[model samples]
Target: MKVAFTAPMKPLDHPVPSGDRTMGRLIVRALELAGHKVEVASTFRSWRAEGGEDVTREVKKLALTHAQEISEQWIERGDVPDVFLTYHLYHKAPDWIGPYLCAKFNIPYVVVEASRAPKRQSGNWALGFNAADAALAQADQVVALTNSDAQCLSQVLSKDVLTVLPPFLEEARFEISQSVTKGSADGTIRLLCAGMMRAGDKQFSYMVLAAALKQIADLPWRLTIAGDGPARAEIEPLFDRKRTEFIGLIPWQEMPRLYRSHEIFVWPAIREAFGFVFLEAQSCGLPVVGGRVFGVPDIVEEGTSGLLSDEGDASALAQNLMSLIKNPHKRENMAAAAVENIRKNHSLEAGARGLDKVLHAALERHQFKRKAHGGR
Candidate 1:
């Protein structure tokens, strides 16, 4: 399989530590692991955070430019892609290249994490929303990362087209080489949180975490935060300087060590699409504490691998943290379970196998459809 993979929300090589970028890289790697050749089709981003007339016009212009550039490259090389795969399609960032190029080449087209909502058709992001809808309708297979995403897309997608592929992490990168041991009785609980300090939901999550920590100020705990973004100045003030140490974006290679050293991973995963960081931490033998809403439940097994509190509830978040802090036995059990759960369900190998199945099915459908249309 020669797969032309793309992430229109943000390019795979975009110099940012975003979830979309991470997922794009993972998906490409997964396809390669499944014995397929993959190439980055384009790094042209079509993301518009605040969509209005100017943004809409810019997105439209970019779409045209992307189509032309990709088409010219295909003609020059004289090798059309066997399959076109896109990641993270939503109202704010819709794909316009994959559908066009796949149609032109008469190849299979698939979308990972494609979402649609009819209510968004009339709003500031009306143009983006409509464009996303158009792309979703054209996709031969739509891979949903969670049941919620599947349910929402089922209304617009056929039952056979909708499938669930949970958020995953590179298990090899985070595997513990030695026997797992519980945190020592040093009496100082160490909590770790890693994420880009961006605005919107990211900032809101940081704010909620800071409030939760404030509620448990008397607890003997230290926090290490690893990430940097545009909102660092604003986000830094939210945490108490004495208890929290901001590392300002550690390298990806160093993340496994960071998680291994920590006892608990805390992040108020507000509106997260099954945060990969949670899986990364778990894979490194660290339990998690996160919100109960959205995709967190899909990743973190409540009461086994970690604990979850109500979304945006500072008190409940603090309480959940306190439970883990006071109960070392429970924390130790959860830590072991965390690693096990990730190995069994959310490993990169698992994701690659699942993708391989989907790709085979999509190819068969594409062949059948083309034959039915007189091999056009």
Candidate 2:
């Protein structure tokens, strides 16, 4: 099968590293691993951070023009895709190209991680909301990355069209050769957190983490944060200068070693969409402690691979951390379980199999629809 992939929120090759970009690349890789030829359909990003009627109109116009040009090129080159797959579709970054291109070529249109927010229907993002809603309605298959997203999507689309595909990682990419033991010889528990230091949700998460660390000040632990962004000035002050080390922006290739060297992965993942960092950290045999919000629990199996505290509760987070810090045996056992859980559930092979099943069903559904509509 030939899949034309588009990520309207962030392109796969975008220089600015982020979870969205990583997930976009992973989706393409998963499709390829499923024995499908995948191509990035376009790099035209439709994301609008701020809402304005004029801005929304201009973006929609540009996206239509871009879609027309792409369709022309595909027709000329005889390279029309069998399936058009769009990732991370929402009001902020609605996909205008995939549906247009699929209609033009009579191919199956699928959306991965499609989120619908009803509150945006009558606000500054009204146009974007409408566009996204239309795209979801036209989609042959809507892949939700989390159950919460699936529930929201079900309100607009038929339940039969929506499927929940948990976030997955390429386990081989983060695998280390030698065995990594938790805790240092100095008897200090090394904690790791990798996330962009930005405002809004991230800043709030950092605040919670800092507060939790303060509660556990008596423990023998050190935190190493690996990320940099605009909110660094505001977020850095939240942590204790002596206990925290800020290592700005780790490269993708070095993340495995960073995870292995650390004993515990601690992050108050407030409102996170099943953090990829959790999967990456657990794959390297490190126990995790995160906030029980959104999809964090989906990745970090509570009591098995890691522990979760109530979202935004610093004291709860501190207790969870203290539990692991006070007991090395429990951490070691959870570390082993973390690695096994990732290999069995979140590996690339498992993700590829899931993609294969859904995409083939989409193709079959499109065929049936076309045949029922007089073979159009």
Candidate 3:
């Protein structure tokens, strides 16, 4: 099937390196891995960061123009997409092209990582949120990455339209990286945390981590912080600079080694939507410690692959850190379990298999429905 792939939040080829972009590319790769011919439908982004009526109006106009452009190009080339697939649909950014083009072309429309908040229908992002809701409503299948999102989507979309896809990693590279042992059981416990130093919840998570580390000041550990962003000045000061080593921003290829070199991966995920880092770290055989809220539990198996603390509780985070620091055997056991968990559930092959099932089902259902409608 020819899959028309697009993400309104950010294009797959967007220069900025973010979890959203990473997942978008990963989803594309998974489609290809499943033996599908995928095409980049558009790089146009319909993001409304600071909501306003004028901004919404301008974006809607731009979206319509882009949709027409794609339609014209497809007609000229005589190559219309068999199915329209979109990734990441939220109030801040929503699908404007796929939904329109799919409706016109009578192709199956599918969404990955789509979240709907009906309350936003009258807010600043009212236009974008409604646009997203309409897209999901038209969608033949919606692939959810977390149980929280799945539960919410179930209320709006039919059960057959929802498919749960867990966070995953391209494990071949990580497998090789993990094979080369880096960190050791030498008295020093190497703790690593990596995420862009952004304001809001990200910075809040950093502050909580700093406070947690401060609580365990007496513990034998060397902290490595890997990330850089606009909020660095505010975030770095919260930590004891002398005790923490900053790696600034790192290249994607180097992340596997970084995770392997660290004995533990610690991050107080403040309102995270299932962080890919947790899975990446665990895939490299490092035990993780994060907040026990939202999608954290979906990735990190408590007392198994890693541990979780109560949300926003730095003291609880500190205790979990201390427990891992004090017990080497437990940490090693969790590390083993973490790697196994990734191998069993979060591998690229697993993601590709899951994606194939949903995509194939969508195509089949679309054909069945079309036939039922007298081949319309």
Q: Pick the candidate with the highest TM-score.
A: 2
Q: Each candidate's lDDT (Cα)? A: 0.87, 0.90, 0.88
- Using Cα atoms with residue i matched to residue i, what is each candidate's TM-score against the true structure? 0.95, 0.97, 0.97
Segments in model 1 whose C-alpha atoms lie over 4 Å from true places: 176-185
Spell out the clash pairs found in candidate 3. none
**Candidate 3 TM-score, true structure as reference:** 0.97
Task: List the lowest-lDDT window of 10 residues for candidate 2.
Answer: 175-184
Give the poorly placed runs of model 2, Cα more than 4 Å off: 178-181
lDDT at position 23, candidate 1: 80
Using TM-score as the measure, name the better of candidate 1 and candidate 3: 3
Please list the residue runs of candidate 3 whose C-alpha ends up more than 4 Å from where it truly belongs after superposition.
Answer: 177-186
Better of 1 and 3 by lDDT: 3
Clashes, model 3? 0
Question: TM-score for model 1?
Answer: 0.95
Task: List RMSD in Å for every model shown.
Answer: 1.8, 1.2, 1.5
Ranking of all candidate structures by their lDDT, best first = 2, 3, 1
Can you rank all candidates by TM-score, best first? 2, 3, 1
Residue range 335-357, candidate 3, lDDT tens digits: 99999999998888899999889
